[model samples]
Target: MPEENRTANFGRGVFVHDVVIVGAGPVGLFLACELGLAGCSVLVLEREPEPRSPWKADPLGMRGLSATSVEAFYRRGMLHPLLKASGVNDYPGADEPTSPRGVGHFAGMSLDPAKVDVAALPFRLPSPAMEGVMSNLEAVETVLSERASMLGVEVMRGLTVSAITQDDEIVVARAGEHEYAARWLVGCDGGRSTVRGLAGFDFVGTEPQFTGYVVLATIADPEKLRPGFNLSPAGMYLRTPAKEYIGMLEFDGGAFDRSQRPTRDHLQAVLRRVSGTDVTLNDVHLASSFTDRAMQTTTYRQGRVLLAGDAAHIHSPLGAQGLNLGIGDAMNLGWKLAATAHGYAPNGLLDTYTHERHPIGAWVLDWTRAQAAVMRPDPHAQAIQRVVRDLFGTRDGTTYAFEKISGSSIRYDLGSEQPLVGRNAPDLRLEDGTRLGDLMRDGRGVALDFSIDRRLHGSAMGWESRMRYAAGPARNDLGLGAVLVRPDGIVAWAGDRDPDREAFERAASHWFGSPAI
Candidate 1:
């Protein structure tokens, strides 16, 4: 049966679910997976009837997974399938001579892996996962959807949220004539989000500096354009390995309206101006326009209606940070929202979602804005770009850029002085050969005692169901005796000696809430 028809059966009925997620894109699906794993009933509504699009396949839809998102996937056992599907497992290391290694970029400036000093990143663990991986947008959506299905999440297609009304207890989302009720509603929809609009969020940010284009078309003369990324007086253009796809950026002060359809002539003219070549596009398959206009919601949650993904924030896809940022939002918001729905969250757990993620979103917007500023065609921007290029050639500069772009340097201010606190717990290898990531597959906080002391276990007894106890030797403890890892893989607390019973209890209470009486 069609999803729309199935939904029509639910017309005007007060069918209540634990959570109703608006949008079935990567971010929404991933959030659904997290909520389902944590035992929350989730329903996803998608505006599109089907989930396949040619533009969402490789070459045109490739997205880079930052280390933060990669670690989240690894923790949930979702990374292996993505790696296999995208063939990213073919290259294990940068030294592999026969394979193309994973390389990073900053504002079209390539940062060589050989120049990055790995030793400087003190908290990063040695893991099979690389610094980054590339996957198609469709592949990520597929993997997330599969996991969500396995976790028993319901996804309804061809359903657009037309209206939303929320009381103190629940939110009612209307799709056409049908209505669905939930304790919470999150808008994971794209930039033009209906949920955000209807929910009355203050989306404030700066305007765009350029109008970017991603095109898939056949070239009348392939030799007219260069083989790789080339920058000229007008803007920057990249002829990808796949001959059909080309990306160009023109600093047009955001004049091109994306609401209009893109034509082949417009793309060809833009290519000619940017690449300094009269590249004639014979046939156009898909064409899309974007801008560097950065914006983010003033708050992530307003009452029972929350926001995630592009609905909450948007910026230029310069470093491909938009996808990673959205995924990170889902990861950070999932556990807290799940706990709240289950009636055990602390006083401010739900509110921390915005506090923790909003700054990161703001930083990403500024980062992209900086890239746009330096990537402009003006002489001043070119001079600054030259200086950055020289800096990227150095070890410190390359390392800093790689770590920042890869999201390995993200550290939350969890009000703890411990170095490991508020950072991603190192992927420690336990004595039995089980990795810390392996233990987190079930999405539960861990009370890890590296020394087998068992004191932390006693301290964590009351919160047994929410946090699991594990004790054993690790290959490298990094001078840590015990660590408290949240389900999101963030270290809430760490100690160098025996377990700090009082401190451990305080940290556990702070993150996991008061234990069962």
Candidate 2:
């Protein structure tokens, strides 16, 4: 570790930053807690000399990934009981364990973002650094290494990068003997991304139907194995174990990815088919593995090095939707990389993170290859996965895949959003009694003051000084009427009716190109 003693400068003089993440995991510690709370100046690096425990490594892909993006988790303020054990739980039940080939009956026909339709607001949007960077990745690397040390952000660790160049605006980096420099460089490194193979980009796609072995172990009698680990019309299981073992296991698809794990005798025949019919697999304490993959990187950014999460898409944990699409690619590329490193955007908004997370990572790997083609073990695909898991149970047809990809059904086709074009801006539930996830909890970007709707006289006070302007009336709480909210909560203008102010200042200058009042 020499190179002139690993070139110190972590946060001493405080010059180098407008962005500089490398690998802090969970989308580079939620994009270094959203570019250090948008004041900018960040630096992560990490080679994992520490952080993320319970012997860290595997533990992600969170079954269908979305507990409101695990309460904005980027180490949720360094771990507040991992955000009080990420609230709401009865743990798996849409027709428990049935997979002799029936996939928990389409999880009882899916739908339940508390009952979609502008989603019924089950609450989420909190992100103490995404619950302290997904605590247990060594408590998200000790809450993003002490939130990159009290938000000044600069990690370093076993220093590695190796090399990188740039010029025409300084980029340089080298690590493993230090060199560093940055105008912008982020490659949340993973999915074997050596900075997307030294910025050549391309992580295209393919592979992963099975690789096997996935057991997270943890069960201290969890109510004497709650009817043998409930959840299995053929998938998902968890209880958030407290003192022993039994609360996680992901085999072929979205479960711990060891390039596709499986085969310690297929995880000892599914831990002896969930320890039953005469259980006996010792009081096993913990197990480990990972390699699961999916691939996605047509581009996250190259000219300055970008890549995010499992290095811009690595799929297969089917509905676990790759760490909830990398915590929505770190809140949609952390406010467009802090509005293109504070120039107020317009570097083509950092090429909209591959025109918006490469079509939500190719439509979440085309519905995880249509739920991995109903896990074809053939026998007519296990008799059509047992007549669509007992005639559509665990919400099988995924409710037509939640009426076509439910990431709350994203829109941004990049069309000049006339009114947030398709709709999604209804975090709903508001009256002055906050919630749209507590008014987007200071991520600092919203303009939703529709004068409530049926248009009226003026009252924006210059759109509340550039943001968070919520004028309730046109509709709220799942009704979604006349809207506009950006500061990263997305939905930059949705409506059922309610307009004016030159089309809300031309959709806030074509969505933040400028001029919004």
Candidate 3:
């Protein structure tokens, strides 16, 4: 069914959307695009009227997309636009595997890209999105917003969701005198989320260890601070290529009052203390404060209202995991939520969103917590930092960190003993030059049969609307005859030398409901 036809008027004057998303940021916009692509009527409400903000552009808003997050864009056919908007000329080495161009920092310690053993990584394949990208919040949001608009997603700006009321069948969000009704609601608002509180979700996590600051100011003495990430006995400070842009971390136990805008004098004092240099700030242009106060909702979904992005989990921007984590959440939840909204989802499919994602969220929170612990300005932390630094100097250590930071180590426990079953399906290419990413653009599960007989043809046909079947000899089968990938690119099942039709059908039915007549 078309998305336009999905919007229905419930008698009276009320029209119910398939999903109403709060916050038009990257996560919300990406989710909206997914739902819209699945032919679901989506309405997005954003508290900010204007999409453009200084904090969302250039150095301040700069963020890193993990390799997995980059693949999500490629799978959805948005990679080129995303790269173009991000000012990247082109991503090289799509046809051949290579070492990652960069391995982002852990805490304040930067990793050497050359030390990452690319061969040791499992299930990796040559593809355009094999590497991560450096992008800003603005560029990411712009790409998703454009896609969402094309898919008929309605985004209402300057609307704050003051109240949320949900019954068994529908959810209504009230803003001022107006109300928007939808079958489901999602909160993608930031860390201080109003939707998370209004929906009555229990948020629990540790307190802040340090107060971090990102400042764009005039450095009177440009050479006082060293370029790149610097860890001192006091704390850590980062001086980027952008001369005015600076990052600092102070272990005052997150004592810096974030409520009040940081002043030039206060920023200078903190900079001097952390950098151990007499650096002066002539004028402070843009400044924002964050803490290592990691927190996450006890549950992502509270009845008809769900949360994504920073609304669901928050930690310091230590390894740039927050954005990537949220994007992963949206990708995983989008298809399941869309299927549920469209009424074809298998039993217990919606529940899998939490089951699959909560652990990943918990891991990220702990990842940042580990970084914070090592970055602390204490003797015990310093001792651990020395050991960690020594470990990071090794090939094995770099490879391990690469796996985590690149998001390649994530594997959902799908009750399968097969190692590949729960991992992200690599860009498996057929002998005819077709790629799995190409086949997944339309948001549907995919069954790739590498057998010469094309054995799963009939079984795949039964769920044609929910799954795409492609059969051929694989360029590199990775020791598998067949693989079933979920709509979100997770490998649901894998087959051996000779694929079994019954097993494929069972996996198909498990993920995509019963077959069509």
**Model 3: per-residue Cα lDDT at residue 97:** 79
Segments in model 3 whose C-alpha atoms lie over 4 Å from true places: 1-6
- Relative to the unseen true structure, what is the C-alpha lDDT of residue 511 in candidate 2, on a scale of 0 to 100? 54
lDDT of 2 by residue, 146-228 (tens): 65467677777777797787754547678886666767888887777788888788776776544433355433334544432
Judged by TM-score relative to the true structure, which candidate is superior, 1 or 3?
A: 3
Candidate 2 matches the true fold with a TM-score of 0.33
lDDT of 1 by residue, 1-517 (tens): 2223323323445666779999999999999999999888899999999998886788888888877787788889987887877777463622212211445788888778787777787565666555578888898998898999999999999998999999876788999888888888999999999999999999999999899999989988988888776777788888878998899999999898799988887888989999887779999988899999899999999999999999999999998899999999999999999898887898999999999999999999999999999889999999999999999999899988877887878889998888888887878777787778888889899888886556776787888778888888887788888889999888999987676789889989999999986
Q: Poorest 10 consecutive residues of model 1 by lDDT?
A: 93-102
> Which whole-number lDDT from 0 to 100 does residue 150 have in model 1?
96
Q: Which of 2 and 3 is ahead in TM-score?
A: 3
Error of 2 at 482 (Å): 10
For 32-137, candidate 3 gives per-residue lDDT tens digits of 9999999888999999999999999999989999999999999999999999999999687468779998999887899999999989999999997989999999
State TM-scores per candidate. Answer: 0.95, 0.33, 0.98
Q: What number of clashing residue pairs does each candidate have, in the order they appear? A: 0, 78, 0
Note the residue pairs that clash in candidate 1: none
lDDT top scorer = 3
For candidate 3, the TM-score is 0.98
